[model samples]
Target chain A: MPETETFVSKIFIAGSIDAVWREITKTDEPQGAMFNNRMHTDGLALGGQIRMRTPDGKYTGVIGEILEFDPPHRFAHTFRFTHLEDAECVVSYDLKEVDGGVEFTLTSKGVAVGSKTAKQMKSGGGFICKTLKAIVEKGRLPLHVWTIYHVLKALSFMAPAATKSENWPLKGNGDAQPA
Target chain B: MKTDSFDSIFQALAHPARRRMLDIVKDTPGCNVNDVAAAFEMTRIGVMKHLAKLEEAGLIHSEKSGRDRRLYFNIVPIQLIYDRWTMEYSGWWAGRMVDIKYAIEAGTNPQEPDA
Candidate 1:
């Protein structure tokens, strides 16, 4: 087997197992904010397909076959985005009860070792874990939402310019401050 | 999106020498290469290589004036990275809260009328 890197994040939500499972598997926008890209899926069952669109309107679809299904406890699936023909990763969600709430563990594996995607996923996993914890504890979206939106907007501007020039002033870490 | 940008940033910061250089500039802005080199035990040329990597990652900026080039830390890129990830996770949490609210309501009023 080839060496692969994995990213794991766990969140404890004040909810029941069934409710948490439903939120993770179902709930699409403009109904819920779980996935912004407007996922089109049949259901959370074996051999189900999942697809998501980029904020820029680009589409990446994946075939998600359930590998493990333990009601209200665990769900695992194999995912492959359309752009990554040679890459197929496994994402699993494990739920457990603790102190009148549920602990959700999200794990992604089979990412290419030492690859850029793996690094981003690792950083993203940490940030997501922290943000999820904050939301659950405070019971509200963060006030810095607009700051985040603008950051993404800036990236959209700089990404194309980066390909053109090596010394572009816009090129830097993803955490660039907005101009 | 060009995902490689994030990788290059991390890769540039992967080295301890580069990270230390960043920390120094962040603490004391407008420090020249010689000033940064004095803090490290490595030779001046060795430190320059690390600074070059950081400059490439856009973590630091340098400007030459007269005989010295002053280096300043740029923190905007790091901030952008933090914002994007935070928003996505926050969205997930909001969805989870909705499900929880419904579950709690349903559990409390099994006999009550559904509205």
Candidate 2:
């Protein structure tokens, strides 16, 4: 089998597996909280529909159907958007009970290596995992304080880039920062 | 949207050896093609071909002094990739949490539910 690329994010949730499972598999709740507002989904049965949208609407939404549903353990679904076109990918969550709580792993699979989707899926795993931890533990997520500073830097980078004397690339070691 | 530099950047970075070659050129700015390949115990011509690809990708440039060409890193294309890959995502990723702080601490009650 061709080894497909996957984006894996692991989070330790203090909540019980059932509670986390409810959060992941629950449907049709009032959609306004940090966890609830980001994604809206219909029934989560096999072939059920799901959609996730970024708050700013920059990425629009990824709409898809559930491909696997094993409550309190695994949930997976198809993921597609206007940006991704027809490249089919699956997003899955696997929950395992740990010492004090649950170890949650979110994975996005079937991404072709070196594609933009691959990059997004890779980085997105970190973002989503951190956001999930923040919401489950703290009741909501907050912008990483550093993110504000980086956003301005990013805008500057988009402009006519300066030469390397300015340390222009900013030289992050490709590790995901705390969210 | 793909840029012309995008493919070259990924292609140049596809191999661990090539990336190591770039690192060698980076530490020793005046390093020659043979110098990069020697670090990996590869043939000189083989390293020359690798450096050629790096040069093609705009990741490094060479200057001929006498008969030897000294290699120097040109990070513009790498910077472009960094801009596209990291900065672009950070913008929206931050936005995803814009209202989260307020949502959690919404009222006097600390244990308030997210409505």
Candidate 3:
């Protein structure tokens, strides 16, 4: 196989596995841990399409296809950023019940070496893990994150109309369709 | 999150050797113990000890990939520390730093020399 990089981030969340799983897989509201992006999906099924959009629904940041969707344990997807021009990468989440709480691990594979996606993935993984821990343990986002959420929501109107969820429907093939 | 306070992270980062070890692991993702040990003149056991401390602080995560354990530097702890200290003001500071850089590149010298 060609050279590719993998990043793994693990966090011990002081909460139940179900809670952690719910936070990661929530599709109804914006996920504060994930930059306040509300996940839009047909359902949690293998090969199903997925999209992460701004809370205000002005833009979609990421699109993916579900690879694995075992409840409360494993969830894997092929992630592709709508704005980035890189090949799709696989992201997986694993949750295990530990003594005090659940151990959550986020893994990304097939990342092109030294690509912009790699840089974003590296920085984003840590932020996601840290925010997820805080949200799960404290039941709220950090003050800074809360401020960012509001700022992002307020500025979402400036996002390109091509990124609207209506333009990128979840009925396409596994490949990301251009709007 | 594992009952570890910021003190643990600070202590892990206190030693220069440990900091260098972290850099090695970060530069070479999916590296193994031997790969890291080869970079330092210290004994393998000494390197392992430092790695242990880094792992204890959640700075490094190891996964068993075949017979060799793959080591990856985790940045969450450092990010958490950074987020704790800097808030919205940090963005303004960062913007100013970028502006200073551009001005310096253009020979504008926005800030006056220190007295």
By lDDT, who's the top model here? 3
Q: What is the lDDT of residue B78 in candidate 2?
A: 56
lDDT of 1 by residue, A1-179 (tens): 34775555554566566766655564243112232333444455666545443344333334456787778888888765443434677878777787667766666778777665566555554454444444454544455643664565456444432222222111123112121
Local error of candidate 2 at B10, Å?
A: 31
Predicted candidate 3 versus true structure: per-residue lDDT over A43-131, tens digit per residue:
77997888898766658898999999999999999998887788999999999887788878899999998788988998888789888
TM-score of each: 0.45, 0.45, 0.82
Per-candidate Cα lDDT values, in order, are: 0.59, 0.60, 0.84
Per-residue lDDT tens digits for candidate 2, residues A1-179, read: 33455554555567678877766654334222223323444455787665543332223245667889888899888876434444878888888787677777676768766677777775666555555555566665445523543464454334322212122111232111111
State what share of the real interface contacts each candidate retains. 0.00, 0.00, 0.55
Q: Which stretches of candidate 1 lie over 4 Å from their true place?
A: A30-35, A54-58, A61-63, A81-86, A135-137, A145-179, B1-115
Candidate 3 achieves a global lDDT of: 0.84
Off by over 4 Å in 2: A1-3, A29-38, A53-60, A143-179, B1-115
Q: Provide the TM-score of chain A alone for each candidate, in the order shown.
A: 0.65, 0.66, 0.90
DockQ preference between candidates 2 and 3, better one: 3
| Backbone clash count for every predicted candidate, in the order shown | 11, 0, 0
lDDT comparing candidate 1 with the true structure: 0.59
